[model samples]
Target chain A: MMSTVLAMAAKDLRLLVRDRGGLFFTLAFPFLVAIFFGSIFSGGSGEPRQLQILVVDEDGSEGSSLFVESLDRSEALSVELSSRVEAVEQVRRGKSVAYVALLPGFGASLSHPFAGSPPRAELGVDPARGAEAGILQGLLTQFAAERLQDAFGDPSGLQENARSGLQAIELSGATGPQAEGLKRLLTEVDRFATTQDTADGQEPRSGGQGGGFKLEPIRIEKASIIVAKNGPPNAYAISFPQGILWGILGCTAAFGLSLVSERTSGTLVRLQSAPIGRGQILLGKALACFFACSVVSVALVIFGTLAFGLAPSSWGKVAVAIACAAMAFSGIMMFLATLGKTERAVSGVAWASLLIMAMLGGGMIPLFVMPGWMQTLSNISPVKWSILAMEGALWRGFGWDEMLLPCVVLLLVGSVGLLLGTKLFRWPNA
Target chain B: MIRLAGLTKKFGERFAVRSLDLDVPRGEVFGLLGPNGAGKTTTLSLMMGLLEPDAGVVDIAESGPPTDVGVRRKMGLAPQALALYQELTGRENLRFFGRIQGLSGTQLDERVDHGLEFVGLTPRANDLVAQYSGGMQRRLNLAAAILHEPQVLLLDEPTVGVDPQSRNHIFDNIEALKAQGRTIVYSTHYMEEAERLCDRVGILDQGELLALGGVNELIEAHGGLGVLTITTEAGEVRSIETENPVIALADWNRSELETVRSFEMERPGLERVFLNLTGRTLRDT
Candidate 1:
């Protein structure tokens, strides 16, 4: 019986090798996808990537130019100057995270503490990148606040601006209590500015609490949870997990389709006529799918290690992950085979179902990048467990204790699918 | 030897095989003759243990039901449909089937080669079956069935669609197997092939066996009479039905030898016997 099962599985493997399209989906396509995504995410260096933004300066004044320079000097931001239309276009096209456009009154508003209107900066940001928009807004506010600090540092400029503001208010001809209050406030500001300027050899109160007004800059220190020595060597370590899922999906679809083809082609009837039972037949199919999955996944990991600097902390854990993933997907293959009768029908349904599983399971996108609700939903996907198990060994530096959950989940999923698939299986004529 | 006692199978309200009782003794070539829906394939499936009988048993080699792996090992079936992997070569298909049948190593290789040679597929053994012609595929199906050298072989519609040459080739292969004293059950709707090869023929209709006996025995019992035609020199034609055409012809020659320019005789065959029993031609059914 064992010999018969092995023979059956061997035959399926031989057939898979001869099918060029199946072979490509099973092996080559997954590798190429890994390389493509890995290269994109690697970013060619270990340094943290800066949030890029475009700056549009309509004010065209020293104050506005200085603000732009300060933003350009920020380590967290990479600024590019462009026209308003071009800046918005770049932000819309996802070439830049957001755009900062300074209006015409920005320069004058920066010099005059008591001005007609405060400086205005319009932000055009990508809707999909809502997180980055908040960060960009915070950076813009910090740079604008620095201008206020500069105004306080030089009281001579403040006094001159205050006298011009008071003259303009008085010439405008208003006699209301509110107008009297504003004039009185400007007169006090002029007196204070003159006194501070007249004080001899006094250094600027850049950090002093003068006149009960002082701006304290908050310095933020950056850090990472993933230790450099234990973290992934490159993005390929992260991408190969998703790539392995694609390979497993290919195997699942191919094996499922092959089952329907066998029935339609009458080869299944011939198999039944042999001295093998139905259980053995299904087992043989699952074994074949498992072997194919394991081979494709192992080959992908090996290629990743050699070509893309994927460094798994533990080879033995990697093997365990591969085995569990293969087992889970083989069971899935069996379940998928029962979805339809004809090869065309089975192929359509299997791919649609598998694609959904892949999408939810982090086969298409990295799980860490998904939203909170999506990550919670991913727990239901075998792909999530597969990737988690793989990442644990490859770069997450998860010890055996931490690896228990994913392995157990994978095994449970495999067992359940296998049991259901076996119960639902039907012969060609049945 | 193969025996099916009171074998019954049904699909919904329809009887596929009703109370089928059959026995093909050792070394006999049994032909199961039926029309499109006459339960031939169903009966074969039961014999191969692919289906369970609703109310009976199928015994092969007098050991047990074919459902038992040991009993099934003694039987082989060539289904009407061509069963093969198109992606694999003819040699690979045979080898795989052989291995599943418990043949391995040098023995497996030899039997695969022999089976391919027997099917006239040796020259194209290494070519993928997808590239093979329909006739070649049919031949390979037979080869796969007989590759294991089973004690009892069941062939269902072995010559469904083929040219005359391929049909003859299959007949020769069956004859060769029969000569080896193997118990063979052949199922087909073609009466001529049955008349040519089957040791005993069973005529079936609507899931019931209408007649079962030697080819001549069934014909003699069910066939009505022989038709004799006499054509005179003046082109006058006369027809006579008789039990003994040779005796009738002798009397006609003595009485009116010169008046009869030429004569012809038509004997009752399986076709007539089937028509006589079913009230409809086999092809019509």
Candidate 2:
């Protein structure tokens, strides 16, 4: 019995070697698809580019220069020097993100004591760089507050004194209190200047404040992606299932033809007269198909690995999965073969069924993108579970825990198919 | 020897073979003669254990069909259809079937070689069945069936589509097997083959056996002693004019017919016997 099975298997292998079309479909096609998909998905790892700014100082006085210097030190903006006209033109032309224009304070306002209004800086920004503009505005406001504390001398009284000074200047209608407030603000700025120096001296903020952008730092650490456990996502996972399905489909077509030929030729009648039992004869044929399907599965795995970088971590699991898949597929082929009376009928039905399973079960399309209902529907397809189990072992780095379900499903499906196949199998010319 | 008693087979609502009784003794070739759909193949299937009989039992030697592994080991069968693989070479097919029949290693090699030699396909043994001519394929098919050298050989129309030369070769091989004391049950629609080769013939029609007897005995009992045809130089062809053409033809002188190119006479062959018994030629449905 062993010899019979082996002999039939050997014969099937020989036939496979002779069939170039079968080889291409079972092996080459899957490897090619894997390579194609791998390349497409390869670039999913790396971080996204920072904004540049320019500051223009028109007033040349201590206050204008200090404010300009503060803006230049900001982490969010990379500050550079330019004339006010040049800076505005740069921002408008989209070369620099935004321009800071320190207005001419003329220093006289700060020389007075509580006599005039505070000086203000004008910002020229490109609205298109909305995120950068917002960051610049926030930094500018913080810098102003720090400068106010120094000019007022008393931290608690700074806000009130600044406000009262600006109000008096506005009421006088002569810019007297605002000029004094501006002078007082300049005197306070000198005191706040020391804090900037201290923080800068401390840790050299590597572009300051945790690398500028407020969101968590995006670091793309590259590691090999396993779509399944125990292996890298590669062609073998896809092709192995396809090979099993096609191998069985091919066997069905061939065996069905052989059966019809035998009946038409009358050999079934002759075999009937022989001493061998029908069970033995059927067993021999089924064994032949099973062996053939296994050969095809192995070939697909080997070539798929070589061509598409499919590497399974565990050979033992892969072998088991292939065996179960092959046996189940062979059973399906035999059962289908028995159902049809003519070779043409068998071929048509078998090919149609194979295509449907292939398409639905990730043979032609990845199951990841399949709709939820379709994914659930795939449970009934042996191709789906076979592919899942094989891929899980090879690409998904699946341990026994992850692998158990698919394997069990495959085994159950195989047993059912084999039982049905054997029961339904018919002898030609009987 | 093979024995089938009260063997019956049914297909849905119809009985293909009904309570068939048969005995094929050791060392003799028995022919199961029938027209199309006469349950000849069905009976052969029952004997081979390829089908379960609706009733009765099939025994090969002393073993029942169901648990007759020993009997199976001693049987060789050439199915009515071509059973050899088309993709494999003649030798490979023989070896494969030989292995299935329990021959292995050097034993398998020897059996394969012997079977190929017996079928006169030794020269084409390496050629794929697909590459062989129709007659060559038919011969190879026969070789595969007999690779195990069984005690009982079952052949179902083993020479169906072969040329006359190949048919003769097949006949010679069967005769050699018979001479070696192999029990043979041969089925064919060719009445002449049955008449020439079989020691006893069982005639079947419409799933029932019409008659079963030796060639001479059958003709004597059912066909009125046989027929003789004589052709003369007057461009006239006629069967011998007598109540018993067998007696008249035995006394005809070839030299007396000076204008006759050739004249031949013989006992009624299986074809004539079949027509006499069933009112139709074996080939005429």
Candidate 3:
């Protein structure tokens, strides 16, 4: 029985080697899908992708240069300096997500902090990047707040700006009740700066801290919730799971088609008539599909590791995932074969069903990007579990207990599929 | 030896094989002659245990049932269709079947080689079955069937769609297998094939056995009578059925019957027997 089963599997492998269409779907197509999606996710690199933005410094002053430098150093934004015209053109053309421009008088206004037009700057964002635009705006605000902190840290500069502002106001206007109130505000501001400068490192006096008489600037500290080790090293680490899913889908369809072909061609009947149990035949088919899926998966992972820096955290866990995934998809192949009696019927039904599974399983779109409802629906797809299991070992940094759910789901689904498929399968001409 | 007792099979409302019984002695070549839908293939499948009988039993030399692995090991079937992997080379296909039959090492290699040579496919053995012509594919199918050297060989329309040359090659192979004392159940619609090859022939129609005997025995029993036709110089034609066609022809010449012009005689054959029993030509069905 073992010999017969081995012989059957060996025959299927030989056929697969010669089937060009099957080879493409099983091996080449999945690689292409991985590279395509990986490029989109990682910008084709190991680092997390940054939103590209252009900066136009019209003043080119020390303050404007400082602002540009701050934006350039941000982890979320990749900044490039350009002319205002060039920056606007790039944003309009969708080349950069957004651009920031600093007009003249921006450097002079930086001294007053809140007195004049508040460091005049223009933000031009690509309309399509509404979400990213909000992030960019918040980052610009944070950098501007740092400038305010620099102003508060130097009380002498604040006093000099207040004295200049009061002299200008007195020369431009005659005295009235409103003028008297402005004059009172300036006198108080001038007094506050003088006291802060004289006090030198002492805590600010209590009472006049409100109404533009500030004490200290607010600073925001940022941290990421996701642990560094738990995230993927590159997009390939994430995309390769989908790639393996594609390969498994291909194996399922190919083996399913082969089973129907054998039935229609009468070879299956011959095998049944041989001195082997019917169970041996089904086992032989399942083994062939499982081996094929495993080989494709391992090859894709190796290629991804060598070419794209995809690091699997645990080899033992990787083996578990691959074995379970292969088993699940092989059983799917059996069930698929039993769906129809003819090759054309089986091929059409199998591919359509697999494509749907692929769509739901995060093979077409990443699970993180899916809508909440779709993500919940994906739990039912074996593809989702297969990819989840693979990702857990590869980059998700899942411990053994964390990995148990997807692995167990895969095993249970496989066992059920194999049982149902074998039970429902029929030999040809019977 | 093979035996069937009240073998019956039904598909939906149609009876595929109805209450069939027969015994094929060891070393004999038996023919199951029928038309396209006459249940011959279904009966062969039941005998091979590929399908279950609705009622009755298939006994292979009284070694229990054909469903037994030990009994099945003694049988080989070349089905009506070409049951082969087109992508694999002929040699690869033979090797696969040989392995499935539990042949290995030197024995497997020798059997594969001999099977290829036996079917005259040795030269094209390395070529993919898809690349072969229909005749070559048919020959390779036969080679695969005989790779295990089973005691009983069941061939269902083995010469289907083959050229005359390939057909004769298959006929010779069956003869050789018979010479080696293998029990063979050969099925075909071609009566002449049955007449030429089978030691005993069974004629079947509509899932029922119409006649069963040697070719001569069937013809003598159910072939009716010799037919004699005479066309006279007066443009008159007469068909006379008689026990002796030669005697009838001599009588016609001796008579003053419009000065005999041309005469012909039709002797009883399997076709006549089939027509006599079923009242329909084998080709019609």
Candidate 4:
């Protein structure tokens, strides 16, 4: 029995290779789907989209420009510098999610550091977009902290200046060591204020803090992370598996069609007369289909990873995933073959159902972009489980246990399909 | 030897083969003669164990039943349609069937070679079945069935729609199998073919066996008369049936009939027997 089954599978594999149409659907079409879908999702950037924000610098000072530049450094936010009027009009017209304005004298506030009045920055958000509003508001505070840190670079120096400014405000200045500390701290502040004025292209007032105590301002120290915070997001990792599922769908359909073909061609009748059980014959054919689907799946994975740069994080899990998925689809093919008695009927119904599953399962569209309910409904599609298993094995970093759910679901579904198909299958023209 | 006792099959309310009883002794060529819609194919299917009998049993030699693997191993069947993977070469098809029949290695290769050569397809063994002519495909189908060399060969209209050359080739193979003392039960819609090859013939129609006997027995029991005919110079023709054509012609001449232009005799065979029994021509059905 085992030998017969192997012989049957070998025959089917040979036929698959020689059949151009079958090979196209099982192998080539998958890559086409992957390439096309990957291109669409990536938009040539190969990265997921980022949150957008507009920055309106009302002050036109060095401090305001520095703050906007800091916001630009964040990975999550994409900031566009615009005029206050244009920013306001853009946000009001629903063109931008929100905008920030840095008022005049914002640059001068840097001179006193923590001791002076806080920098005046206004964040305007659209009331209609509550999610965007909250996100932009949180990002504003983070940007503000980063801006302050870069501007001073010397935290202890800023704190000392702040203490001296407070003492000057109180008058009756400190005596002894504290008096000298205040004197030197005030001089640092005076120097910072001079730098600010110079940076703004304005003349420094000679008597701003008793004149001659102020030293010449040096360059403000800056530090930044020169490397990327994250790696490039590959759309092929997601699309390739979905494309492979398309091939699985095609493979299943071909298997389904084979049952019908056997009947029409009188091969089923011949097998019936052979010294074999009915279950054995059906199983042999189904095993052959399982092989076809698995071979096509592995081939698609290799092609996708090589040609399209879709790398699976764990090849072992990928092996298990493809096995389960192939079995599931093979069972589905048998079940589909049972639906219609003739080849034409079986193929028609199988393709229609498979296409629907593929569409819902993220073959044609990413599930992330789908509506919440559609995503939930897609749980019923076998293609969904197939793609989930593959993606998890690929970039999703799924371990053996992590990969179990989708594989189990696929195996169970496939087994059920096989059971139903076996139960319903009939000899041709009986 | 194959024996079917009250074998029956039904689909819903209609019976495909109703309580058929048949026995074909070892080394005998038995033909199932029937027309379209007859239960001949159904009976052969039951005998081959391709289908389950709703009512009775099929015994092959001393094997318990037709469905048993031990019995099926000793039986071969060739259906009317070409049962082959068209993409594979003829040799490949033979190898596949040979393996399924439990032949392997050198044994399988030898049998495949023998089958290909027997079918006169040795030269085209490497060509795809799809590329073969209809006649060649039919011959290959025959080869696949007999590769295992079963004791009993059950053929169901294997020559339907086949070219004359292929049909003759298939006929020769069947005859050769019988010469080898294999028990053969053949089924066909053509009465002439049945008469030429069968040692004993069973006529079936509408799921019932109407007649069963050797060619001579059937001709004697159901055969009516030999026809005597004469065409006069005046273009008048007259015909009569009798046990003796010579006596009928003597009577015609004694009756002072006009000068005959030509005369001919027609003999009663299986066709006439079918017509006499069923009141319908063999081709009409």
Candidate 5:
């Protein structure tokens, strides 16, 4: 039985190799896509892209000027000083991704121990540039966290206050006012320990009658950004996995169409007439498709590694992720093959579906840059899970624990599809 | 030997093959004579266990129903359509089917080579099947079926659309297989091929067997009359059907027949038997 399966698989592989069109889409197409998308996202050297952020400092204070200088020195953000109206207009016109504004008298607000509610920086951004806007917002928040923490007087002393305050709360096991405030402070201290505090999310306050300043929380104009101290991974590292997935999908479409072709050509009936079981026959075809899809994915990874310098965080995890993804797509091929009676009908439907899946799954456009609703909807795409798994393996530093969810989802898809395909499978005559 | 005991199959509301019973003795050459929708392919599929019988069982040589792997291994089928992968060489396609039939090692190689030689495709075995002429592809399809040398061979109109040369080549192969004492069930719409090859024939129509007997026996039993075609030197042609050819010829003018440039006399064949039984041409659906 095993030998029969292998023979069938070997025959399919031979045919797959002979099919220049399938190979072209499965292998070469991914490389071209990777190059095109990767080069567009990165300069192809795998270095992180510098986000251009225009700054208009209306408060001619030392602190405001210092903030602009620091933005220019940061590795991720490229800052340009511009007038408020010009910067806002540039963002509105799509000329720039975002602009940060220093509200008037921002310097005295920070210099005095909270002279009033800490002056907020007005961040005007173009929503179309969601990814770049996210990064710029994170940078601005980090800067704000640093200034807020500075208002408390020495960093070590503040951290000591936060650390001991947490110990007091723990020892007391109390829901007292000091502990509640300290719990929030400890969360802030954790952020502070990493780099700068969660300044974008910090609470600022005006100086009350007390000798020290009371912090008041300031909002940064509806901006929501999570500060990643390690910064974002290089764009190619992100784009290459999507390219590999496109290659896998291409093979899935090819193999799915091949099944319909086999039935139309009557070879499927010939195989059914043999001594092999239906399980063996479908297994052989599934194995063949799986191998083809896996090889395309692995080849793209190798190309990305050797040529584009994509160093995945863990090779073992990537292999497992790719295996799961290939299995899912192979099962999908079987399912789609059974959907239509004719070869042309199957090909048309399968390609259209795969293209839509790719579009929604970050194959055609990056999910990060899409609108909020679109990004949320993309979560439903299996391609998104595949991309997430692969990104985690490559640059997200996803260990097996983090990789298990996508792997499970992918395997579930494979199992369900395999069941449907097996149930619905038919020969040309039968 | 193969047998279908009260076998049945249905498509939607209609029965494709209903309560069909058949037996083909070992080493017998049985041809399924039918029109387009006569359920020949459905019966073959059920017998191969590629499809399940809706009501009854399909048993082979008392081993078991065709669902048994051991029984399945004993039979081979060459479908009406060419089943070879166009992208693969003839050798590869033969080798693949050979391996599926449980042949491997040097045994697989020798059998594939023998099949290629038997089908007269050895010279071009290395070429892709897409590049092969229609006749070559038809012959290669035959080779793929018989590479494992099964005891029972089911060929379903193996030369449906091919040039005359290819058709003749296929005829030769089928005849050779019959000569080898392989129990054969061949299906086709062509009457002459069945007349020349089948030791016994079953005429099927509307999902039922209309007639079953030796070809000559059927012709003698149901044949209406023999057809006579005469062509004059002026390229004019005429056809007549008569029960007694000798008397009919005697009644005709000798000079008129002498002027006939070409003459053909077709004896009662499967086509005539089918027409007599079903009152429809073999090509009619």
Candidate 6:
């Protein structure tokens, strides 16, 4: 029986070597699929887009000019000048992410403020790009608030007034280190106020003068950017999973078709007639299919790593994952072939199953973009688990804890498929 | 010896073979003669244990035909289809099958050479089967089947689609096997082959055996009288009655039918006997 199985497997291997076209379709096609999809997901050539914002300067005051100068230093926004109508048009057309419209207000309003209503700035933005637009709007609003305080010359006056009021209350004796810290903070504010006046080219105001206020310079230090400790987010990372999924699916289809051909050609019937048991014959063919799938998987992995820079942290784990995946696919394919009585039917079912699995398993699209329900539903597909397990081992830097679930799922699916396949598999046309 | 008793097989609603009973004695060439779909192939399949019988038993020698490994070791089957791998060379295919049948190393190489030589394919033994002609491939197919040198050989339409030269070579090989005291059960639709080779022939039709006997017995039973023909000039004609007309006519018509262009006589061939029993020409069906 062992000899019969070995003989059958050897014959299939010989046939595979003789037929160049079959070898290519079985072994090389998967790597081609990987390269094709890898290129698409890696974002091979397009430049990244930057946010564009239009600044409308209706407030012709020096304070507004300072605000515009501050906006020019922002790295997040590419600022441009335009009329309200032009800015609104640009925002509506998506040419600019958002428009900053300064309302018309003369310099006389700030000199005689009565606090009836605060001035308003209008921001025009497209809703589709609303999130970024909103963030930019918040940043600009804070800038405007700072500029308004600078114009009024009372940025720290409110803090100083609160401190004096608290001192006057004297709820407890002000003899502790807390009182000394408060005094030090007040003196620093005074020094900042003095510097602000000199920087603005204004004379210092007297301490006891009526309606006198001071401006304290507050320095806003932007955060030092912390670059992420990883390679650039690539489209290939996503494409790699897709390629692996398709590669396994292709192996299943290719091997299933070969089995169907053998049945049609009467080679399988002849094998059955030999002094071999049906179980031995089926096992022989299954082993051949498994070997073919493993070859294809190896080819795909080599090409993926070399051509696309897809490096797996653990080669051993990746190999095991690929072997399990190939075996699972082989089992499913052999089962599908047995269910079919003809080559056409087997090919049709194999192709349809492959496409369906590819679609559901994030082969063509990333699972992150899929709806939660659909993502959950993908657990039923072996392609999904296999891809996830392979990606976890190869690209994702996942430890065994993270990788264990997908591997277990894939193995379970493989076992079930093998059980059903062995039971369902028939010799030739049954 | 191959023996089958009450062996039967059915496919779905159709009974392919029904209670087939026969014994192919050792050292004799047994022929199974039947038209297409007449249970000949089905019975062969059952006897080879390729298909499970719906009823009864099939045995080779003392054992049965779910033939044990020991019995399988002593049996070789040449199915109708080309069973040898097309991508392997003739010798390689023989060696592979021989190994599967338990031969190995030097023994395997020797058997492979002998098998290829038996089918007169030793010269082309190293050429791939795909490179061989249909007749050469058919011969190689037979070679692979007989590579293990089994005690009994089951050949199912072993000469189909072969040129006459190759067919004669195959027949010669079978005769040599028979001469070596090897039991053989040969199935074919060729009546002339049955007449020339078989020690006993079983005529099967519609899943049932219509007749079973030696060549001469079958002919004498179905064929009422012998036939004799003598072609001569218009003026020379004569009628002669004798059980052995060909021998008697040679002496009688040596001078009388001297102007004869051709003369032939036979105790009616297997074809005639088949047509007489089945009421239809073997070739017509």
**Steric overlap count per candidate:** 0, 33, 0, 0, 8, 5
Candidates in descending lDDT order: 1, 3, 5, 4, 6, 2
**DockQ category of candidate 3:** medium
Among residues 3 or more apart in sequence or in different chains, the pairs in candidate 1 whose N, CA or C atoms overlap within 3 Å are none
User: Per-residue lDDT of A73-170 in model 4, one digit per residue for the tens?
Assistant: 88767789988778765554334656777777666564544344556666665322333444655666666665555545554555555565656545
lDDT of 1 at A382: 93
Q: Taking the tens digit of each residue's C-alpha lDDT, what string does model 3 give over B10-47?
A: 99989999999999999999999988999999999999
CAPRI class of candidate 5:
medium
List the candidates ranked by DockQ, beginning with the highest: 3, 4, 1, 5, 2, 6
On lDDT, who's better, 5 or 6? 5
Off by over 4 Å in 5: A43-109, A113-233, B225-244, B251-266, B283-285
Candidate 3 per-residue lDDT, tens place, A1-430, comes to 7888888888998899899999999999999999898888665322224767888888788877887887788887778889878886656533466777777766666656535346767777753344455576677778877886676577677677667767766677646554455556666657878876455564333323332343222121211212234446777777888999999999999999999999998898888888887788889999999999999999998999999998888988998999999999888888889999999999999999999999998898876455457778998999999998898788766778868989999999889889989998987865
Lowest summed lDDT across 10 adjacent residues in model 3 chain B is found at B251-260
Per-residue error for B33 in candidate 3, Å, reads: 1.1
* lDDT value, residue B145 of candidate 5: 83
Q: For each candidate, what TM-score against the reference?
A: 0.76, 0.67, 0.77, 0.77, 0.74, 0.72
Instruction: Give the TM-score comparing model 6 with the true structure, all chains together.
Output: 0.72
lDDT minimum window of 10 residues, candidate 6 chain B: B233-242
Higher-lDDT candidate of 1 and 6 = 1
For residues A282-361, what per-residue lDDT tens digits would candidate 1 score against the true structure? 88889999999999999998999998898888999999999999999888888889988998999999899888888888
Superposed on the true chain A, the predicted chain A of model 4 yields a TM-score of 0.61
The best-first sequence of candidates by TM-score reads 3, 4, 1, 5, 6, 2
Query: What are the DockQ scores of the candidates, in order?
Result: 0.58, 0.36, 0.76, 0.58, 0.55, 0.29
Q: Recovered native contacts in candidate 5, as a fraction?
A: 0.86
TM-score between candidate 1 chain A and the true chain A: 0.64
Model 6 docking grade:
acceptable
